[model samples]
Target: MTEENFLLSRVKRFVGSLAHCRLLGVTVVSAEPNSLCLELPYSEAIVGNPDTGVIHGGAITTLMDTACGSVVICALEDFELCPTLDLRVDYMRPARPGEPVQARAHLFRQTQSILFARCEAVQGERTVAHCSATFMRIGKDASPKAYRDYITSGTAMENS
Candidate 1:
């Protein structure tokens, strides 16, 4: 398989196993060297304003954060732990209810310890939000054993 496909598969598995994120239904639609696209399913629990039928800003932020981190992980070709140092988001429009939002993120640049990325949330042709983020890459062995175990187990299942 191609490298991009390999990384995408790995990310899919990792995200699927994250119980706290409720990421079981999310899917990685595309992945390249610098960019990744994700689909977030709509749920009433994630709604910010019930009257407006809009998803919360925190939910959108989580999408952007994960997308950026996935870009870095794909680029590095390793499951290194990277934490968001900063994230700035601009809401262009409200996301609609019952629509699965698409999040696209691109890694703009990276240094030894930092990676910069930009992302956008879109529904069809309309832009809902835009974000820029910085991530601090930790050491290869810096991740906790629980995380390592989860990822490794998921990776094995994905490869099969």
Candidate 2:
């Protein structure tokens, strides 16, 4: 298969394996080269404040991290692993309950071993949160055997 096809398949499988992600009702809307968009359905249980029913900060952070990692994988066009080196999130406004949020990640650049990404979570036209992160690409030799096996077997790695 072509590299682009291979990376897309890998992203699909990885997203499926995330149980918490599944519970959060996250879906991969689109992916291309160094960009990806994710949809997250609102859940009452994820609310931090019952009075206002605002979504928890942790939940938003997870979405950002996932988006960044996916961007790295798509840009590399490989099943290689990349881990978050740093993540900084700024909440501009509270995400109200009962509204779906969309997260879009863009890879700004890559230099040496570091990949830089920025992501934003939005509800309709309103911005909910913004995030910036850096991911360190793990070398081929450092990649987990399961990932290597998937590439060899021509099956995408399900998850970690």
On residues 36-130, what C-alpha lDDT tens digit does candidate 1 reach at each position? 99888888878999898888978887787778877786677567878889999999988988898888999999888999999999999999999
Q: After superposition, how far is residue 99 of candidate 2 from its true place, in Å?
A: 0.7
Q: Highest TM-score: which candidate?
A: 1
Predicted structure 1: lDDT: 0.79
lDDT of 2 by residue, 41-157 (tens): 888868888888888988899888888877776777456677789999999999878888888999999876889999999998899999999988777578776766664345655
Clashes of 1: 0
Q: Which pairs of residues have clashing backbones in candidate 1?
A: none
What is the C-alpha RMSD, rounded to one decimal, of candidate 1?
3.4
TM-scores vs. true structure, each candidate: 0.86, 0.85
The clash count of every prediction, one per candidate, is: 0, 0
